[model samples]
Target: MVTSARPQFTAFIGQQLLASGPLAEVAIAVMNASRNPAAPPIIMFADASGQPIDLDLRGTERDVVARLPQPAPDREAATEEASTEPRGRGRPKLGVVAREVTLLPRHWEWLGSQPGGASVALRKLVEEARRANGDADRARAARDAAYRFMSVMAGNLAGFEEASRALFADDRRRFVSLIAGWPDDIRDHVVKLAFSDRAEP
Candidate 1:
């Protein structure tokens, strides 16, 4: 628990009829009077109507205590939970390494549009995206890796399917990359189709 004596900021509504002076000046004066030397520094602002506000600064002992957020018992627990929460994991896990990445608005929106849903496991989503948008090299490698994928990780196929679906749903990069990597055999099949249509004519 962080138990540091510090000043805080706060505000109060002022009644216009009692307006004996400038509201901003009154707020600053109150804050100055309320601030504790031993506590942290605090800056307060006026309400929309411009009135005197009260803020509580912590730890310093003084005749006038600012109305700062008081130290509560559960505060420690809440802070612990917040500090330990993983960045993008959506929740905390014991042994997992959590990493942070910034996504554009469209990426988030697309993720939200996936079928099995957004709350779906991110690992699956990421792998799916990797697979769906996999390059021709990846496709060839994946085809080559098919034996391994089947042999070593067939048990995880269901997970692969779901993630692949999400990734493919909106991936243009992988879409272009993987198609560009089509194997010779698949490329030949397309050539064969064109020749067959001409031959039929």
Candidate 2:
């Protein structure tokens, strides 16, 4: 999926890629394509999750764009507002949520002895775990996203099952070989989604 301030989408007519960009542009392309009586079915996909996107392309380009979901609130502005808010009598609002932890006695003792007590210690531990597993997590997400798109677009193609197995096995070479005979656009897009985080070998 796309990683940017604005999400991106891709539209394909059969195995031919029609458009790839921000939602408005893709939606406009789809709208235009739909006008052709002989045009094949158009499928749109959200780049981030590789999920199919159903567009409301019934009206003008302007109407289609207007129907798109609104962008999320500006995070920078929200952070600024939160920082400038007046503090109450209690601890400063650090956006910390209180949740119960069910740890053994020894675990609690160790956390209690940490420099910043249980909460800080727990946060630190969680952060460390995330850092350690970050690459694996990202790779897994990419694999899943690619699989989702492949299931929709290439499920009936030759070697689809083998390609899927190779994908989950993290065998890039095998996956590529398995899908070598598929349509160019579909193969290329699958590779892009499955290995966006990795350098080309």
Candidate 3:
């Protein structure tokens, strides 16, 4: 049931964070609460990558969610198209496309020599690469996402530089130690964003 569409978010009211969780709709609601003239000048909502999410305050909550980026089409569903006609040359019933791939002569020769032809070989190579790099890719993404949140919310805090160093180095202990003095909500949210994808020690 894993889906790339699930969004993660954090909200801030001035320098103090208000909440961190899924659902941009809820984040927008929290941001709205702090929008009065007397409140802090900046009420921001950022995604897991720390990019600011623009919410049109005049719209309904559902409208706000609808404005967020939707997931790409399901590949499996797209490939399942039922057709009565024959597929054309270089076209696949699996929805494959025949794009010109410029490869060195030797590379092309090697691919052509594979059992099922260049296309099948290339697909196998791609699937193997994805399987091999999946974990590393997810870890790198987590680090980047956490760093984004930290830069926006705690860049000026004490030990931020050291904390950042520890974060990139994957030294969880040192990172936690450096940010221990930050406000409870901010510290907790940072830890969650950084480690939410990682398994417990």
Pick the TM-score winner. 2
What does the lDDT read for residue 30 in candidate 2? 92
Best by lDDT: 2
User: Taking the tens digit of each residue's C-alpha lDDT, what string does model 2 give over 28-135?
Assistant: 999999899999989999877899989789878888999998765554454455557664432334444566889999999999999968876897798689778878
Q: Give model 3 RMSD, 1 decimal.
A: 4.3
Off by over 4 Å in 1: 1-94, 115-121, 129-201
Instruction: Please write out the lDDT profile of model 3 over residues 1-201, one tens digit for every residue.
Output: 232545656677776766666757555757577557787645454555766665555576766777766644655354344233454575554566767889999999999999878876898899689778877777787788778878877889999999999999999999999999998877887888788777622
Looking at model 2, how many pairs of residues clash? Answer: 2
- Give the 10-residue window scoring lowest on summed lDDT in candidate 1: 11-20
Q: What are the lDDT figures for the candidates, one per model? A: 0.37, 0.85, 0.72
Error of 2 at 100 (Å): 6.9
True-vs-predicted CA distance for residue 185, candidate 1, Å: 39
Instruction: Give the range where candidate 3 is weakest over 10 consecutive residues by summed lDDT.
Output: 76-85
Which clashing pairs does model 3 show?
none
Per model, how many backbone clashes are there?
A: 12, 2, 0
What is the overall TM-score of model 3 with all chains considered together?
Answer: 0.75
Candidate 2, residue 33: the lDDT equals 92
Please state every model's RMSD to the true fold in angstroms: 28.0, 4.6, 4.3
